[model samples]
Target: MKLMHVDASPKGAKSNSRMLSGQFVEMLRERIPALSVDYLDLAQDPPPHVSGDFARAIYTPEEERTPQMRALLEPSDAMCRRVLAADALLFAMPMYNWSMPSSFKAFLDLIVRGGVTYIAGPDGYAGQLARHKVLFLTTRGADLRDGSPFAGMDALTPALTHGFGFIGVRDPWFVDAQPLQFAQPEERAAGLARAQAELAMVADRWAADVMSEAA
Candidate 1:
């Protein structure tokens, strides 16, 4: 199976989320020896924001579009094709001002196309990219889990879930290392340990499932 791993942290190697994701990849690699991974660091290479020309290319018929229109949409088309090609996607991101990083959002804008990824059906909207799985590895400086005092303030995961679901991911699961800034050393250590253990379970299960299906 193929996995697309996206890192949206601007801090690069210093990012805790990045470290966790790297560990996840290493552990998963042991389970699925033949698994192929394509990594994208959005902080280093972010997609362009949606523009008027991109809008025109998407709205215009493919054959009728000019070279300029094609050029405008080329990057977006490539990004979408990568997602479509992958069997599963894994995202590692940190919270930024109660939401995702702007680089990740920009990447989404370049990929989410109208007729290419979705269309208006006679009945209702339909998603072209379906039956895919998504895993979200996230870190937060503050507490925002289900029972935290600031539970209602988490605009990150909800927004991401909606955005990814809109593009046709059927199952999206999240494992978080929370309260990074607020936790004591022991608490932080425990949280990281828990997150890594959960990741191990997820990876082992997914690898077994894929192998069984292929068999």
Candidate 2:
């Protein structure tokens, strides 16, 4: 199976989200030796933000699009193709100011094209990238679990799930490293260990699911 890992942290190697996502991939690799991995570090190579040209190009009929329109939409089309090619996609995300990093948002904007990724349906909008599984590895400075006082404070998970769900990546798994900056050393260690275990289990289940589906 083809697995893609996208890291959105500018923190580079020091990013906890990056660590956990890599760990998940490594564990999955061990379980499914045939798995092929693709990695994208958005901080190092982020997609260009959508522009007026992009909007205009997508609005134009495909058969009638000119060279200028194709040129404007080429990058977005490539990004969407990569997503459609992947059997599973794992996003390594860090919460910045209660929201996703700007680079990640830009990446989303580039790929989530109207006709390329989604389209109007008889009922409503329908995503073109259906049947692909998604897993999110996320890090935050504070706890924002459902029962926590800071529940709605997390702008990351909600937007991530909603946006991806809109594209038909339904019920994506999430591994959260939370309150890392505020928790005591022991607490932080314990939290990391717990998340690691959770992710390992997820990897195992995901491998079984993907391999069985492929077979």
Candidate 1: count of backbone clashes, pairs at least 3 residues apart or interchain: 0
| Candidate 1 minimal-lDDT segment of 10 residues | 124-133
Residues 55-126 of candidate 1 have per-residue lDDT tens digits of 778889889999999887888888889988888889999988888888888887776777777767797767
Off by over 4 Å in 1: none
Report how far residue 102 has shifted in candidate 2, in Å: 0.9
Write down the TM-score of every candidate. Answer: 0.94, 0.93
User: lDDT for each of the candidates?
Assistant: 0.85, 0.84
Query: Could you tell me the lDDT of residue 193 within candidate 2?
Result: 85
Instruction: Supply the global lDDT for candidate 1.
Output: 0.85
Per-residue CA lDDT of model 2 for 1-215, tens digit only, reads 89988999888779888888888888998998888988888989987776787878888889999998998888888889898889899988888899888898998888777777888778899887678878888888777778978898887888898888888888789888876677788877777887899898888888889778878
